[model samples]
Target chain A: AQTVTQSQPEMSVQEAETVTLSCTYDTSESNYYLFWYKQPPSRQMILVIRQEAYKQQNATENRFSVNFQKAAKSFSLKISDSQLGDTAMYFCAFMNIGGSQGNLIFGKGTKLSVKP
Target chain B: EPEVTQTPSHQVTQMGQEVILRCVPISNHLYFYWYRQILGQKVEFLVSFYNNEISEKSEIFDDQFSVERPDGSNFTLKIRSTKLEDSAMYFCASIPPGLAGEQFFGPGTRLTVL
Candidate 1:
């Protein structure tokens, strides 16, 4: 079984300030994928970034990046130059690469607020 | 870019009434999924459909819940009898044949059961 844990339930950062959301997971599988998804007030789930366990390098997408520590099973997201639009719930998810059923196991999520 | 779409952005139904949530995945995507999120809760997987059959489902998907791909494009999830707990945002996602975990999500349909 796999489980994703988001330690921070809520966080706030001022506009233009950077913030990091923590995430950790428990999985025995060697080959897997980790992801950061953003759900805005509209409640639409949007992919922020993804990291593969096989890759030692982290993943970065524009202002969103992930620090994926494979050995520690930690995949955290860092938001740089945060804007008001970045205020949303961030969820960490996991998926095994070998499975035919591509189901995502998501964490409880951290609600982020960007103050102007 | 191709995207997934869902209908009935919001639906309100009484208890014991049936409700069907519809989704249209990307045109060429073969795998489909349904996930739900209660208020202030994490998103939970409900079921996954592949090749016109259910490939995987969570324990939360009970006998009262059923899914079908009646047409080639539209995937539907039907709840036989709505419960107050069923009031949540239902998200539809789809993945192409070779994609790993990069599933495209729809805007979601908010189902409210009273």
Candidate 2:
């Protein structure tokens, strides 16, 4: 079974600054997917960024990016030029691309507060 | 943008009562799933359905829980008898064929069992 771990319980970043949320996972599958999802007060799960285990290059979308170290089993999310809208509970997730159905395995989540 | 939508944004039910949660996945999506998150807990996958059949299910999806796609557009999850432990935010998600890993998630339905 794959398990995602987000060591940081809470994080704060000043507006316009950068913040990195740490995440690690334990999975034996060679080819898999790592993701970072954001949940605001609305409780809607929003996709922030995703990284394919096979892809050596990290994935970046707008201000969100991931630092994926397959050997270390680490996948961390970085939010550059952070804004107030970034305040939310961020969850790290793992999925097996080879399985019958790739169900998501999520971490406890890191509550982020973007202070103005 | 196309997205998954769930009905009854919030539901309140008494213990032992039955409640059905509904979801309308993207029109072109071929895979559907149900997940739940207890207060202050990580989201957990309950079941996944594809081609009108269950592709996978977690141990948490006991006989008391059922899923259906009677209508092509609506996918539903029904709890035979609600329990206090069933109170949580239920989320529906979908992924189009060929997009195996990237899934679109619904806003989620908050189920409160008392």
Candidate 3:
């Protein structure tokens, strides 16, 4: 069984600054996918960024990026030039590349607040 | 952008009553899933469906819970006997066939069992 852990319960960043949210997972599977999802007050879950375990390079999308360290079993999300709209509950997820569809294991989540 | 749609954004039912939540996945998606998140808790995977059959399920998806695709357009989750612990936000998600597909999620239905 794979378990994702988000050690930071809450994080705050000033507008236009940068912040990093930490996440770690325990998985024996060599081939897997990691992801970060955002949920606003609307309760809609949105994909922020994803990283393939085999890919040594980190994944970056707009202002969102991930620091994926396969050896350490760590995948952290970094939001650069943060804005108020980025405030939300962020969750880290993991999925096996070998198994069935859409079976993602998620972390408890980190509530991020972008203060102006 | 294509998305998954869940009906009855909110559902309120008494304990021991039956409740059904509906979802519509992307038109071309091949995989469907159901997940739940209790208030202030982690999102937990319940079940996954593909090819009109259950592909995977979690311990949380006990005999009390059932999933069905009665028609081409609608997928449903039924709780035979609701409990107070079942109060949570249920999200429907889908993923298209491919190696690197991302699961798109619906807005979620807030189920309140009193």
Model 3, A6-106: lDDT tens digits are 99999999999999999999988998999999999887999999898889999999999999999999999999999999999999999997765659999
Query: Could you estimate the TM-score for every candidate?
Result: 0.98, 0.98, 0.98
B89 Cα displacement, candidate 2 (Å): 0.4
Using DockQ as the yardstick, the better of models 2 and 3 is 2
Q: Which lDDT tens digits does candidate 1 get at residues A1-116?
A: 99999999999999999999999999989978899999999999999999989999889999998999888999999999999999999999998868758899999999999999
- lDDT score of residue B112 within candidate 1: 96
Off by over 4 Å in 1: none
TM match of model 3 to true structure: 0.98
Of the true interface contacts, each candidate retains a share of 0.82, 0.79, 0.77
Using Cα atoms, each model's DockQ against the true complex is: 0.81, 0.82, 0.77
Model 2 chain B weakest 10-residue run by lDDT:
B94-103
lDDT of 2 by residue, B33-54 (tens): 9999999999999999999989
Give candidate 3 regions above 4 Å deviation.
Answer: none
Per-model lDDT: 0.94, 0.94, 0.93
Candidate 3 vs. truth: CA RMSD?
A: 0.9
**For residues A70-112, what per-residue lDDT tens digits would candidate 2 score against the true structure?**
9999999999999999999999999898755888999999999
> What's the residue-level lDDT of A43 in candidate 1?
95
lDDT of 1 by residue, B22-58 (tens): 9999999988999999999999999999999999999
Deviation of model 3 at A70, angstroms:
0.6
Candidates sorted by lDDT, descending order? Answer: 2, 1, 3
